[model samples]
Each structure stands twice: as C-alpha cells, then as structure tokens.
Target: MTTTGLLGAALLAGLNVLPVQAAAAPSLPRDGGPAAEVLARQEVLDRLADEITRVPEHERSLVAGYAGHTVDPRHGHLDLYWHGRLPDHVTKVLAAAPTGVTAAVHEASYTLRELRAGRDRLVGAVVRGEAGAVWTSAGPLVDGSALAVGYTPDGGGRHGVATAGEVSARAAAVAGVPVTAVTAAASTAASTRHSDASPWSAGAELTTPGNGWCTSGFGGWRGTTAVLLTASHCGTSGTYRTGAGAVVGTATDSDTGLDTTVIDVNGTPSGKYFDGGWDNGSGYAKRVVGAGRNNVGDLVCASGAMSGIHCSLRITATDVAAEVNGQWRTDLDTATRTDDSTVAVAKGDSGGPVVASVNGGADMQARGIISAGTGNPVVCGSVAAPTTCWDSLRFVPIAPIVSKFGLSLA
Candidate 1:
C-alpha cells in the first residue's frame, strides 16, 4: 500500500524532538556520580509528577494513560516512547511551571525546585474552599504534589506529602511495567565488547569528540563508501555539535519536518558506524564487502554520545507526512514502527541510527535515526512534566536521503 522499502523505511521513521537543554552536562563526581546522578534525577522527576496532576482534567488528560512508571531511583530519570505529537506534553509543562519556563520554548532543560515553586502556586488555587483537616483541606493545584511532599497526607487517603525520593520510589514501585524502555542500554554492556569508540568509517581512526558515541545507520552505499544518515536538526545552526566537538558540517541538506540530515565527515579521522547491531556495533569502512538486503521484523540498534541503544521492529505504519523548508514536500518516506518497544532515545541521541540486524541476522540496513515515538515517556518522568508516546517514532528513508544528496558511500 505504501512505497516503503528497506531504505525508505529508515528515513520515514520520524525521529524529531528538541532537546530539554542546550547547556552541557555538569561534571559528576567519580565515586558517587552514579548514585548522586540517580537521586538527583529522582528529585527532578518527583517534582514533575507533582506538577502534572494539578492541571485540570482536560489538560492532565494529555499524559492520561501513557507509561510514566518504570523509572527507578537508580536511573535518576524516567523516559517514554509516545505515538502522538511530541510537543504536546511540553505545552502542559508551560502551564504548570510558567516561571521556570521561557515563552520562546526553545531547546533547554529545567530544574525541579523551580518546577515545584511554580507548581505550588497554581495548585493552591485548585483546592481552595473545601472543608477538611490541614492535610485534607482544599488546596490549589499549584503544589498539588506537595500533599505528598513530606508526610502530609490527603484527607481522602489517596496521596500525601512525601520527600522527592520517597514520591519517586513510590510511583516507580507501582508503575507495574512500562511497555517501552531503552532496553538496548542494558544489553550493550554485555555483548558490545570491543571498544566502540575507535576507527571511523573508511577504516581511519576518528577524531573522537569529548563525548563520543556510535550507532548503525548509513544511507544506501554507492560502490564502496557507506554514507551516514542522521537528523538535520542535529546539525544546522549549532543545534548539534559533532562527536569531535567541531561543527564538522551543516545539515548540508534536509527535508524539513523529516528529521534527517547528511553530515560530511572525511575518512582521515573516521566518523561512522556500519550497521545497527546491539551485540557489537558495526565498523565503518570505505570498502564494500558487506552490502546486503534486509526484511521485516529485524532487530536493529544504534549508538551515540548519549549512549548506544537499539531494538528490533515489527513494521507497523508507513508513508509519514513530510515537508521541505516549510513547504509540503515528500523528500523521503521509509519510516517504520517496530514492535520491539524500546524508547531508545534521549536529547543527544538524535541524528544517529535506527539500525537493523546486528544480532547475527541479515545484511545491515538503516531503519531510521531515533526520531520521535508515540510511546516514549518524558525523560524527566515527573507528574508535572507528564510524558507522551506515539505509536511510531520517525526516521528519514535512507534510499531517498541518499538520492536527494547524490551521496556515494565509500
């Protein structure tokens, strides 16, 4: 019914979302870094959870039934894979945490303390005029989660004031099981044994970035070279920095709203991966010894500076909406929705790969860069920051991407 091939599928899987913050990650303590990061992450999420519940039913319904549970205190963050509009949840955030947020809504992250103060102000209004004890009395939605902030319990016995960590632990404990999680991160440490950050494409050592990451997704190859495929939003205008911390190239070309980009990296300092496998990520080379075909239901994966994560897919939808430079244009349409259910993405994961068949399967192929998904949870995992996930995230079909740019893989 749809004109989607192995190459097309990769491009069409729409992977597009602005980052929570453009600021860099702070230096974490080496010994307590892991634990501290996790706890701090929980504190942030706990505050978000409080804020989301304060909005009116119609608005709160945005995050209604989607998954927000599996985020344990260890990970310090909660994530979702959604199937609908990626920007909707952020709108809800603006409503609750108006102060900490900017009206511009550009890419940036927010803190929990800032969220709570704003959340408390609005929640206080939502619950006024009700007769009850201090804990059970009517309060506003501004600090609705405050009911659970410390030990303050509601009169109805539903929820109460608990500490940030306490609320997070409680919510995560009862989340049951989220359908999607970046399960790829769990697997990479086990099988992807080789030092993944070496040798760029063309077998040349790469000029690695301050924080280098790799993934599997190359537009169809030409003769010998395999061209890399990612998101344009990842490059142009300094939105995305390269692995080498250099603005290596612009998005050279991009089909607007498509979330695909073609960056030009040379063979001298390598900058690419071969396929999308979880066990051992593919190696980049200029030779054409491994070109092959792919099929449905393949297990593709990816790697990036944020960390490598991937999963298989059972192709669901095809022929997604596309536009170029704000014009209605169909540049590429090879997006696929795999049933693997891995919300395998975050801020910096963009312009990477949605690879297929790295688990000892068929010839490699690009499923799509990690665009947007319907089921992906909000990375912050807060009640106030209610998350969303659509049925299919996006990717630019590799076939058309390569054709549009006339790129010949080495």
Candidate 2:
C-alpha cells in the first residue's frame, strides 16, 4: 500500500518519523522527575495487576470477596480492597510483587459482586427511563466506595425530578448504595481518517462504504472464519477498504451495545499490528500475543491511523457506562494521557487497537478498542475528514466482544 493523499502528508508532518524496528519499544513521551517516577511505578503495577487478575475464574476464589483495587503510581503502591478474608491465590500474587512495588489489602464495605449488582439495578432503572434524563452514566468506583452516576443537572426538566440532589438521591435509592453524581460531557465516536497498507494489519485506516474512515482493530477468528474487528458505530453493514482502495472486508456481525463489530475479511488477516511512532506511511508490525483485561492504573497505548501511536496513558476507571451517539454503552473503560500535551485519542481513530504491553514490551496483549472520547480538542495533523483529537478516551473492552462473538485472537 502507498500513502499519496493529503491525509498522508498531514500525518507525516504531525508525527515523529522513526525507523520501524520490530524489537524497539513503543514510542512514549520522555519525562523526568515525578512524572518519570510515576510512569515507572505504573509499569510495575501493570505487570502485577495482570498476574493477579489473570487467574481463571473457576479457580479464583478471591473474586467473590474482591471489592476493587487502585494503583497509586505516584507512591508505587497497589491497594486491593476486599469485603472479607483475602483469598490465598490473591495473597500469593501479592507476595510475588517485584522489588520497589508495594502491595496491600484493605477491608471494604462491599464486595465487587454486590457493587455490580447495585450498579446493574441503577442501569436497569435508567434504561427503563425510571431515572429520567438526569442520569447519563453509572458504575462502581475503583475503591469500592460507592456507585458513581454521571448526571446532567438540568436533565430532570423532562421528568418530574429537578436538581442534581434529587437525581443523586433517586440513583442512590435504586442502586442500594451510596452514590456520587458527577457532571459529564457528551461522548462522540472517534471516526474519520485515512492511511492503511495491504496484508491488512491492526491500526491501519479503513474507509467505510459511506466514504468515512476508522482504524481497524485486532484481527481475530470467529469459529473457523477469519475476521477483522472495528467499532460497530463505524458502520453496521458495509464494505471497508484500505487507503489505497484495496478491499478489506464486509461487516458480518455487530453488537451496538458494546460498540463492537466483526468483518468478514477478503483474505486472512495477520496477527501482527502496526506499532512505534507514526511512520509517515511506513509502519512497523508487532505480534499480538493474546488478550487481557483492563485494570485501573495500568498503562496502555493506542495506535490510530490518523494520529499515530500514543502511549503513557493510565487507565482510571473500568466498567464505565457512557452514552455514545444516543445509545448507552456499558462495561467501557476510560484512560487519560499522563502527558497532557499530547493527544490520547483522535477522531477517525475509532475502532483502533488499544493494547497493553506484554512480555516486556516485546509484544502486545489485546485490551480493548477505541470507542468514544471527550476533552482537549486539538488539531490532529492529519487532513483526515475529522481533523481533531482528544486527551481522554473511552474504549470497549475486548473480553466481552470475544466472548459474545466467540472470537479467538489471530
């Protein structure tokens, strides 16, 4: 594939041109002092968290009493909250923490299961329109403190309720736990861009049938069929192509609630994905070893065809429910850039691969796909249709998508 359009030129200007080396670590912002320390701590925490959460559910008894967990990268501490005795498996995981990392367990008022039950109740109430328009999103806090409900203060005008206080009260009653209401910004899908090569790989730009564009996600298999993954909001039914006009695939299945879609590829898709800094058209491919869950404080990276690769982002929340394009998308995770000066995600980046470093950054583990974003609107050097970017991002976790679609990583 070749890059010859205006979008290609813009991408070349916006990103740092780097040599594609398969063994090179991903390009992340270089920082010193407190920021550097935080990044270092986050990396160690990420590995430990992965080990702790990777235990199979059937054999993991800790999950029942697991309330939540938080990583204070600034202090190099990982705190696990539980409602009762810490399970032996978790204890073992914590004991194995590498030097310089501190792990501790704390008692919590409720278990994750209980908190999720309450969150589900609140979500159901909102879905049934029983909460009015006051509530926009709801999820449990990472500290197992309370159910956080994102609400619009003036949303109750359409319903009988009036005021943020009333909204919080109603939500708390329904959730059966304490509730914290936060003002939230509306979410928009990050779709629009151009740039992709043949032998299609994740992070390549895909042109939708409507002439719009989105980033292709990881390649996977749906039973015996090879498929490509991308954001469902991109287009539920249509053919997708590369920037050079090579056919990529056609939509085979989609779940709008999760904002995920599977495309029947024209040819077998590769298990590798583009990595490193934006390559000015020449991109590096990194093998995807497997898939993993997203956890708070874990650092991850995103690769968008329009904006290129961005790293040093820390996951702040998980299982977030946000309204995107007028529909409620639950089980979403949100991450924010540690370096505020750079964009974490950009328009036309929708459906791009969001991956966590694995095997010491030698490979990547599929974590999620870019869904929507808000905050810090800035020019994205790409002349792509949507020439903007955001500092924060919301992504659809890969676990549910793989489970619901019966997909296995390619």
Estimate every model's Cα lDDT from 0 to 1: 0.31, 0.72
| TM-score of candidate 1 on Cα atoms, chains taken together | 0.36
lDDT of 1 at 366: 40
Error of 2 at 223 (Å): 3.5
TM-scores, one per candidate:
0.36, 0.83
Worst 10 residues of 2 by lDDT: 14-23
Per-residue lDDT tens digits of candidate 1, residues 1-410?
12213222332232112213212232321111122333233334334443434431112324432211112223323222222233445445433432122111211122223223333332242235222211211111111122121113331243433343443343223222111111110001100112323223321111222333322234333344433455554333222233334333223445544555554433322333433222223442222222221122222344333433334332322232222222222212222234333344433344555543321222233444554432234342211112332323344444455445675543
Q: What is the C-alpha RMSD of each candidate to the true structure, in Å?
A: 21.0, 11.4
Q: Which stretches of candidate 2 lie over 4 Å from their true place?
A: 1-44, 50-62, 72-76, 131-133, 156-163, 192-195, 276-279, 375-386
What is the C-alpha lDDT profile of model 2 across 1-410, one tens digit per residue? Answer: 12223223443333222221122333432221123444455556766776776642212224677767777665667767777666667666665566567666666777766777787787787677774546767777876778788765567344754566777788888889988887665677888224554456898888887888788998978888888899999898989888768888899899998898899987787897776544445556778888876677777888777677777788888777777867888888888888765778887888999987654465778888999876446555533454768888889888888888999988
